[model samples]
Structures are given as structure tokens and as C-alpha cells.
Target: MHTLSNAPLRTVVWSTGGVGSIAIDAIARRPDLELAGVWVHSPEKVGRDAGELAGGEPLGVTATDDADALIALQPDCVVYAASGPDRDGGAVPDYLRLLAAGINVVSTSSTSLVYPPAYYSPDWRDQLQEAATSGLASFYASGIFPGFGSDQLALLLTTQSKKIDVITVTEIALNDHYPVADVMMDGMGFGRPLDFEPMLKTPGFIEMAWKAPIHLIADGLGVEVTEVRGTLDRRVTHRDIEVAFGTIPAGTCGAVRTRAAGVVNGREAVVVEHIIRMARDVGPDWPTSEFDATYRVDVSGDPDIHCAMNLGAAEGHGAGRAAMAATAMRVVNAVPYVVAAPAGLLSSLDMPNTLPRYAFE
Candidate 1:
């Protein structure tokens, strides 16, 4: 068993993008962690200081596009927050490289890794396991939705239940202010024609993308999900809508509703639903969040319960900013636990309670 150390862990920020920048700032604020290096994908970001890139004061560490150079630094953990739309083509290789180099990794890149056992590809899991074992390093993946809201929060609430007939975890977000064009437009099929299918709606893709949490919740509750099923619903705008990334032309896709349901005994015992809108009015009939971003969990059982987790930033900041920071901080805060974990892919259940260490301010 690995023991926690008093000395601050040398941490590296893998990207300076939305989530990665937040990780950089949050890492610097933690006393148990020290900002050591940063790896950037954009050439423009190269040679820039991580702190400044993250909207904070300079921290003396410069960002670079060199992944090998950052790995050579031998930091305790790498906050891998690079985009994961291409999970296998991109994120998996980077993860393998880091794990094989004896560098522990905590990532928001791959939501599928939140529960490694349920990852769609058994071959990939085998490879990751081999790499981690070879280097004696640990790896973990998480974020606000799949990480905390969907799995952790839902499972935590089941503790008070006398019987759990069904547990539904829902994520409702207004992404009008999110600035990632590729993710917002191409990946999610937003601003596309009604007949045009997005990657998310492709057969079995939703299950692959979201089944990790369903399996995790089932395992935690000591139950089994017989089969995983998915559903997708999309809506188009009647008028052009302006957003942080770009404008969504009238009659283009503007909102989406997707769900991954875990069936047990012919019933949807566990379900994860994502309802996202470019404009608030697009999905008026669908579920809405009290805040711009909200995660709601409803448990139907002996004692029915409902809980809402609202995330919001200050006046100048948008809801996406708060959700991004929350996502980044989830993995950033797990660094200590990841560093002290056994050499392998770890889920939340494998680690002890991770508190916001030194976050008393």
C-alpha cells in the first residue's frame, strides 16, 4: 500500500485549454501540489507561462508542445485534460505513454476510464493494465458529469435507501457560452441538419461513452445490469442563435437529449440522462436546470428522494466556466490519491475519500 507524503507532489498540466487551464490554476493553489511543467497542443500557447495562460499570475513554468519533454520531468502526476472526442485515436495513446513511463495520470480526457472494467474495449483495458503494471504507475479519469454527478453522487445517495427500485442521474446544461467549436458543433452534431447524425447518435456510441458510470453504480450497489441501452433526441432552432463558439443557423440542431439506461430485471434500474441546449427556449418541454448547469439525481425506492446539484460561477463568468472548473478540480483534487494508489487503472471505489485538501479559503 502506498502512503501519502507530506512533500508536495510535482504536477504537470497536460493542456492549457478550458479544463486544463483550470487544472493549472487549481494545482498551483493546492499546498500539497507544485506546478512543475505544462504541455500544450496549440503552437501559440507554447513558450507561454502556465499560470498566465490559466488567467493567473505567472508561475515560472513555461508551456511547451513537447510531450516527451514533460514526461522526462518525472512529475508525480499529469493532469490530462486534453479533449477526448477521439478517445482511441488520441487520448488512449497519450494515457498509455504516460502510464508506461512510470508517470501517474489523472485525466478528464476519457470519461470511459472512470470505470475501467466497463470500458467498451477489453483489448484497450488489457493494454492499459499492462502499461500501468510495467511502469508501476496508476491512472484515473473523471469529470463533473461522468465523474461526480452521474456515478459518485448517485451511488452516495443510495446509502440511505432501504430499497432502490430505480436511480436516475441527470445532467442539464446550457452550453450557449461554451467556446469549444469542435465539441459543440462537430462532435455533438449541434448546428447540423435534422437528418444528419452526430457521432453521439451512432449505434452503440452512447452506450460506449456512458456505460462506465452505469456499471460503476451497479457494482457499488452490489447489483448487476443485464443490458445497457441508449436513446437520443434532438431539436432544431427556428431562428438563428448566437453562441460563444459561433452562430447556429435557423433550422439547425440546437439541443439534444441522450440517455444511457442500465437495465436490471427488465427495468431501468440505473439511468444517466444528458439534456443540453444552445438556447434556453430550444428544449422548453424537456427538463430544465434551476441554474445554467445542474446535476439532478432522483431515487425511487422505499424512501423516494430527489437531489439537485447546481453549479454556477460569478457574475462575469458563465455556467460553462463553473462546470469546467469543477470538472478540472475533480481530477486535480484526486492527484494525491492517484499518486498513492496501487499500480493500475483505478475507479473512485478503489480510493479513500478525497477531500478538498488545503482548500479552506
Candidate 2:
């Protein structure tokens, strides 16, 4: 572990998108961390105040497009939130660049990095390991669904049981108020035909995105995963529905339920399931959430255990935005742990409990 300095860790936010915006706000709020720089991809966002981009009071730091300029500053850590459809392919190079430069990384992107050992690509992991080794930096990735709510929470619960059978983590979310058009329409195929294949529903995508949590839980329970498999079920709306993204025409796909499981001894011992709907009423038979989003973990074993976590915000704030804030904060909060860890890819199992530090003020 690296020694802690009395001064705040110099931190840079690597993007100004939804999650990145929240990350900026979070980093600004932390006294133990200093907001050193901000990066923006859009031409319009460049030169804007970081606080303005984050929808907060003006902070002196301005957003820049020059990655080299930010790296030259040599901040202690970077909150990486720049992500698109190609999650791993797009984020890996950025992570490599940052880690190789001795900048520890805590990211909401490339969520599969939540457990580097379980990731499908050995070559990519090797590259990351080599980079971190040379630079003496660490890389850690996590977020709401596949991060804390699933693997971490499930493993926490398992400590109580004498014997275990199956561990399942489920997320039920209503996405009507989420205003990301590209994600809803292009990436998820929310308003597309039932037969239309969305990038999210493509073969191996779910397994790639969520297998980390499944395998992580299995590893925690002293089990081996023989295979990782994904199954997707989508529901079409009977009536045209209005959403923040756009209108979902009647007969268009509006809801999706994906289950990614880790097969242990030819049976699913660990599973991560997502039930997302454009509207609450879209999937009547599916698991429901009182709030806009709910994360549930069920351990079917000697002593059955079930826990549900409901997520929401104040009256005026949209649940979607609140959820994004949670996702962003998850990584932001880990900055210190990532910066202090031994140089390499680290997982939840490799670190101590990461409590919310200095948040009361």
C-alpha cells in the first residue's frame, strides 16, 4: 500500500458526460481529494468551467480536450467515465494510457474490470497488468448494478450463512425519465421492433458486461464457474408511450430482462439479472420497484436470505439522474483506495471495506 500524504489527492475527471458530470461534483465535494482537471469530448464543452459542466457553482478549472495536458499535470488519480457502445474496446486504451502514466484509475466505464481476473480477455488483462507494473499504478472499475449492488452486497450476505445454494442479484429499473436517447434507442433498442437486435441484446454482450459480478460472487463462495451464459427477454408495449428519450410507438420493444449466470457444477450458482422498463406498467409480471430503481439480492441456501435496495432522489430530481449519481459516486469514492493499492488491477476482494468517508458535512 502506498503511504498517504497530508494533502488531498490531485484528481482529474476524464469526461463530462452524465456520469462524468456527477463525478466532477463528487470529487469537488471530497475534502481529501482535489479536482485538478476536467476533460471534455465535445467541442462546445471544451473551455467551459468544470462547475458549469457539472451544473454547479463556478469552479476555476476549465474543461479541455487535450489529454496530454491533463496527463502532464500528473494527477494522482482520474475518474474515468467516458463510455459508449463499445465499452471495453473504447475504454481499455484510455485506461492503459492512464495507468501506464502512473495515474491510478477509478472508472465507471469498462465495468468488466470490476474483477479483472474474471474478464474474458487474458491478453488485455496482461497488458493492463504490465502497464500498471511499469508505472506503479492501480486500476479499479465499478458501478451500481454490476458493482456494489450485486457482487459486493451478495458476498456480504454470504458471510451470515453456514451453507449456500444459489446467489442472485437483480436490478429492476424504470427508465422513462432517463433522457439519454442514444442509449435508449440505439444501444438498447427500446423503441425498435421486437425482432430487432440491439447492441445490448447481442450475443455475449450481457455475459461480457455482467459476468464479472457472477464470477466474483462464485469466487467469494469458494466455487468455480464452469461457464458464463446470458439470456435476454424483451417486452413490447401495447400502446405508444412517452419517454425522456422519445416516443416508444405501440408494438415496439419497451422492456428488457437479461439474466447472466455463472454455471457451477452444471448449475447456475451465481446470477446477475436486470429488469429495465421504459414504464413501470410495461412488465406487470416482472419484479417491481417502489422507487425508480431497486436492487435485490437473494441467497437461496440453508438459511434463505433476501434483501432489496430501493434508490431514488428528492421530489424534483428524476430517479434516472439519481441512479447515475450513485453510479458515478461509486467510482469516485474508490479513488483513495485505488490510489493506495499495490500497482495492478484490484477487485473488491483485494481491498478493505470502502466506507463513505467525510460525507456528513
TM-score of each: 0.96, 0.96
Candidate 1: worst 10 consecutive residues by lDDT?
A: 313-322
lDDT digits (tens) for residues 296-342 of candidate 1: 99999979989999899533356578889889989988998889999
Expressed as tens digits, the lDDT of each residue in 146-203 for candidate 2 is 7889878888888889877788899988878767687778788899998888888778
RMSD of each: 1.6, 1.7
Residue 357 lDDT in candidate 1: 85
Poorest 10 consecutive residues by lDDT, candidate 2 = 313-322
Off by over 4 Å in 1: 1-3, 313-317
Residue 21 in model 1: shift from native, Å? 0.6
Clash totals in order: 0, 0
| TM-score quality measure for candidate 1 | 0.96
